[model samples]
Target: MQDFNGQIAFITGGASGAGLGQAQVFGRAGARIVIADVRAEAIETALAALAGEGITAHGIVLDIMDREAYARAADEVEQVFGAPPTLLFNTAGVNSFGPVEKTTYADFDWIVGVNLGGVINGMVTFVPRMIAAGKPGHIVTVSSMGGLQGSAIAAPYSAAKAAVVNLMESYRAGLAQYGIGVSVVCPANIKTNIAEASRLRPAQFAGSGYVENEASIASLHSIHAHGMEPIELAEHVKAAIEQNQLYVIPYPEAKEQLRRHYDEIVDAVLPMEADPEGARKRTEALRNWAADRARVFQKSEG
Candidate 1:
């Protein structure tokens, strides 16, 4: 997994933002790159940027939510590269903000489908292939700081990202035995076009039309103006992959926030009751759960 030279990388959302940053960095490391995005023009522009730098890369117009399309894209990638990608980045995402009461079904579906469902699709489409190839590989899925902490204004987005964080952790435990390392990236604000994601929502998922809140959009943009550059974050991702780290947290303050969140969860657990029999039974049950999980892993790796 540490090796990047001559490897193949399949990156979603690579038209811009962090995905594009990864393509640039990985391409420089001599990895063959496949940049996939729903926006054709953006993909063209991204490929052109890489081409200008003399990086070996190509683009595929992709919508990760489409299962059939994702399968076809996987096929296309193998045909182009002569093998499946050794690196898979499920980095595409979108968001919408409002009170939970104001959040429509369409809004929830759109945000969740792209942010969480897309990652699920990528994992399902690629993991089996990677395992069958019997090669060392890594998977990195980009969640957000908001995933660790819920946001009232962006409930659906936060919920979806949180799910991705948990999903990746589970995948990490199961895939480690198969030589497929998994990492979930929980990044804070970065200079990206996520605030404008609603504009790119496909018509099929646009249930209720979203009216952009200019003031909030402006505020988000202002904050992003001072955020970390995408390339710097991408470098951190590279280091995390090389080290086989589970979590790629770029913002320094995020560690404190996460600690506080964990502390609150710990505090919520009530003191154990003075019942030895109950405690013994609970311990046995938990032991059984762990054993079951271990057995599943062994069965897969056997």
Candidate 2:
């Protein structure tokens, strides 16, 4: 949105890392901030830090995975701000390292459950409320570069993030008519506490296939230590929202690698230029089907 003054920004995982960075950047630009997270201590700490900066921020203890809790949190925001948040951020995520073959159902449940399921919950819970309010707004989800290029190191994390990338694209197309802008940020490494995400893992998901020791955590921390600062990342995100940009990827260092990967994908696909009749038939068929199933599909234009 072009304006931010007096806008309510509800940020998931707002206690630390990327979420906190958004709270700082957006709050400084005159938006009221809500820091929702699972850790009560972190929420208080984040609130105090924002208080020192004279930023208008409130804290809500939340576990985004719980659909009921997410609904309650939405209600809480309405009660506190007397309105729905115009700026919704789905930024909470988790990661773990293990061989894909060794990864268990539990691993997928915890990692994907938080990473993807949480975003789904947020979208379902808030979209209706925001639409009912009939205000121009924006929704931003934090994905990862691994989402674009799959990672053997963290398969579940990569898979969930990849889904997030596609999900935002669909939302962008669907929400555009409602004056709601949607953007997905596919970031590389960032200086954050995600390395210690294991510490926050609930006991119900304790059965893990990956090793979660100090050494592994430290290794992740060291890699992230050399990564981009959260505030700087937030600056890129702010610009993307203002520009209505679809992809918020600021890592130029990754250009050559991504280009190479995309090239391979293109090489694998059969060029439509060589099969004009087939392409025309396929397009016509889809258009006819979409027209027949109008209620099930968005209308396509000439």
Who wins the lDDT comparison? 2
Q: Candidate 1, residues 1-302: lDDT per residue as tens digits?
A: 67799999999999998899999999998899999999999999999999998888879999999999999999999999899999999999988777877788898889999999999999999999999999999999999998998887888999999999999999999899889999899888888888778778777776654456777678778877887888999999999999999999978877787899999999987677767788889999999999999899789969
Q: Where does the lowest 10-residue lDDT sum fall in candidate 2?
A: 293-302
Question: Which stretch of 10 consecutive residues in model 1 shows the poorest summed lDDT?
Answer: 205-214
Instruction: Please list all clashing residue pairs in model 1, or write none if there are none.
Output: none
Residue 247 displacement (Å), model 2: 0.7
lDDT of 1 at 200: 81
TM-score of 1: 0.93
Model 2 lDDT per residue over 1-302, tens place: 88889999999999999999999999999999999999999999999999999999989999999999998999999999999999999998999998988898889999999999999999999999999999999999999999998888789999999999999999999899999999999899988999999988888998899999999999999999988988999999999999999899999999999999999999998888999999999999999987788755545542
Once model 1 is optimally superposed onto the true structure by TM-score, how far is the C-alpha of residue 267 displaced, in angstroms? 1.0
- TM-scores, each model vs. reference: 0.93, 0.96
Runs in model 2 lying further than 4 Å from the true structure? 295-302
Model 2, CA-based lDDT: 0.93
Local accuracy by lDDT, each model: 0.90, 0.93
Name the top TM-score candidate. Answer: 2
